[model samples]
Target: MDNNRLATKPHYQILDGLRGVAAIIVVFFHLAEPLASNHLDNIVNHGYLAVDFFFLLSGYVIGYAYDDRWHTFTVAGFLRRRFERLQPLVVLGMTLGAIGFYFTDSTIWPLIHTVPLWKLLVVLLIGYTVLPVPLSMDIRGWQEMHPLNSVAWSLFFEYIANILYAIGIRKLSTKALACFVVLAAAVLLHFAVTNANGDVTGGWTLNFEHMRVGITRTIFPFFAGLLLCRVTKPVYIKHAFLWCSLLVAVVLFMPRIGGATHLWANGLYESFCIIIVFPLIVYIGAGGVVHSKTESKICTFFGKLSYPLYITHYVLVYFYVAWISNHNGITLKQAWPYALLTLAGTIVLAYASLKLFDEPVRAWLRKKLK
Candidate 1:
């Protein structure tokens, strides 16, 4: 085998930057989440949409990275790559949550200290696999798949997408994939337009409804991204990163539409963005090249920072939210300083996690497994 062909390829640098940008927005979303009186009013209201954005990016990048390598690859090997890439951070995020759990005791989760250590450890270890724990494992009272780290729900869906791609979906003809993507898109539109909330802002809690939301949110972008990679050639779009970043920010940061009365308004808006807008952004991002050294460095840094930030940032938010609940009626003005600290802390922790933990561990795994 030609070793170079089997080796990993260079990333689409701009997409990496886009991923980082979306990840950062997700953090802001979570921080703002506790502040929202309800899901409708959260200033970073559409921040949850970034998860779907991440799926699009993942689909594009995975298609770019692996579609042509199957001759030399196996399903097991592909899964190994994904596990090494994702699971380490899963463990770290869970650990951080466990470490901070008791200390964050407040009205938000007043029973935090009451949970037995054994149950917490059980959830933590199961979380290492990124599997969704059942309601019986609801140590934190939120009933999330991984209460220690709620974001793992997305990662669980991410693994499903990857497995689907590896086992069968990636084998389909381009025409077939397109048909698949269209069906998936219909699922997404139906859910987004008519769901009870009028927005596609959930999937964290494991339930039939959330599962439908989760599966719908995941498949369309991912398969559409794969189809995009297969059918289109990336074209040069000047200022691609800037344009894409702005589009993402505007979409995610916009206020909920039609208020409580016009849920379909918000639903249709979100559907339009995810179905049409996000894929367009990815296509543009993939096409653009970095022209300046400074911009190149910025993209590289954000690319490295994105996953770790997304995976681990919520550990601190658990406490931030608890602090808010403890202090009744805390406004953003009063909480801004602490919120800044939470943001800064997550950034620092993500950097540390990337360099100090994730990279080294993945390197060692590759060496051993290979």
Candidate 2:
């Protein structure tokens, strides 16, 4: 019966492949630290935009997977599924980070206290919804803003979006129109806040401290994704111009828009993401770019492991670099080897988590809950 049920379900391999792509981009973006020094920061800095891609993708996938079930959106079921999907790997990552911190020097005990037993207890019990502080002490140093459980920050909004969906907010209209309105409001709010703040200096105020602000900015993009699920037009005709126009806008306007520009930039950027970038992703998925029998095997493997890869890669990168710096004279020029090492280690760890942790727990949850 379970096998039959699984067979009947829609399998969006393209979305899985997209997850693989997003995870890889994030890893490479961090890799830039070891590879590019001040000379190439601008070129590589843009890779952070991959997070936006993940956000957009999440919006689409959630909508695609659950739109028909909008009437069934229930708080208990929503939280249960979300908690099952997200918590295993998150807890694993946090636990690993806490253990790593505990084993470090005693002089750093106060900092370790930041992620101490009590905090771990809180995270395990309450699911770590509180804001995370930066992980490293040296604010001016290379990994200044690093946090132990940094990647989980985005999951906060992901969960919020899910909660909103589950609570029957999505049944107000056709999913597409609902998404359009929400996205529009987010963009407008972002612009209003930015202008009111007198055109601030950094990228959109989209980091951890301003999480609520970030969630507001992203809601529209996510809903835009939901709309994509209902899109039936041919991708080439539907999205090509959108992509071209947005690409042109980003290239032409991003530089001139100037410092602390996440507000204006995110609004335009998300528009492009929704109208242009996301469609391209869907096109790639629909095109069977990774759907050959051999490719399917590879994609399935990576797809299954992608979540852990996304969560753990950054933590590994930070710790690997820290350990390396403590032992030897490593420089940015020597980043390739370290990057490769980090990738290899992360992949191994991710695979282990998938097999030993994620899959088992997920199966257990399904059986016990269902």
Candidate 3:
């Protein structure tokens, strides 16, 4: 979610900066993913949780920006505003994926060379709308919602949450909202703890199980974030950005808990982080003030970079993963240089997308809609 949506509202500088931090870690997480045999041993073990953090942030920012505007804001208006903020980059990201798809052929994607140009175009067109394609239409081997740009799966779920919020969830009494959040949290906990892998991953596919995972991941965090914004009082916290950013990084960087024998242990840990630690971080981040010139500039830069970086970076990751898969037995040591390049390249691209496409396009849409 773009805090740019809060143009006239008070911005949570630290939350934006923290989002930037999480976005960057996600890049490294993907980079290191090819190195691991499974989620258990991935060097960036808990990095997938960043999606949950994003859901929470999205909810909080939506509530902060729109909760009081219900008198003037219709559901259509709210959804329009959200689509304006979110869809532009989604289009750009998927386009980038389509452009790179054939070029990134590797042993991992044996069918990449076989995919016809017309089918590629078809998938690209669907991806542009950020809607999930059925498995039968999967261009890539992975049964991803947006095979061209895998990250769009999360965006799809987010849109679902957004629609739900606009239609009815926004009208819930405060007590009712809290009860809903509680029930949602319980479902999330059960889903996480009972899973075979002990982590809340795998929502990319468009199946009943994956759909359940996607919905489960979305509801509690988004509404809990909404609840937080409505009820929490912000007390000034010194160095809140630094403290909160560090806290987020530490949780994401933590090694996987309880090896194969006790998958539920890792699941419990992830649930704890999502349900408890994430809200506390948001509370502190919301309460924070930029202390100095350097801090202010850092917050502004990071806040602007966060969403674009997240949405667009995965296109490059498709190539990076392809490169790694083509080269078998390539150690982390050997891959760091290329990984670093992908990181730097994606950051540069994300910044450019922010300045060139996202801001200009959003400004144009705002004027047109106004």
Question: Sort by lDDT, best first: what order?
Answer: 3, 1, 2
Worst 10 residues of 1 by lDDT: 1-10
Model 1 lDDT per residue over 281-356, tens place: 9989999999899989989999999999999999999889988998888898998999999999999999999999
lDDT of all predictions, in order shown?
Answer: 0.90, 0.56, 0.91
RMSD to the hidden true structure, all candidates: 1.3, 6.2, 2.3
lDDT tens digits, residues 263-316, model 2?
Answer: 455445434544566556655554344426776675577567778988877657
Q: At residue 262, what lDDT does model 1 achieve?
A: 89
Clash totals, every prediction: 0, 8, 0
Please report the TM-score between candidate 2 and the true structure: 0.73
What lDDT does model 3 reach? 0.91
TM-score of every model versus the real structure: 0.98, 0.73, 0.97
lDDT, residue 119, model 1: 89
Cα error, candidate 2, residue 74 (Å):
3.9
For candidate 3, the 10 contiguous residues with the lowest summed lDDT are 1-10
Q: For residues 1-370, could you state the per-residue lDDT of candidate 3 as single tens digits? A: 3333444787888888888999999998999899998778889999999999999999999999899878765787788888889999999999899999988878888878888999999999998888899998888888888999888899999999999999999999999999999999999999999987788998899899899999999999999999999999988989999999999999999999998989999999999999999999999999999899999889889889999999999989988998999999999999999999999999999999999999999899887765
lDDT at 248 for candidate 2? 28
**Candidate 1 lDDT for residue 236:** 100
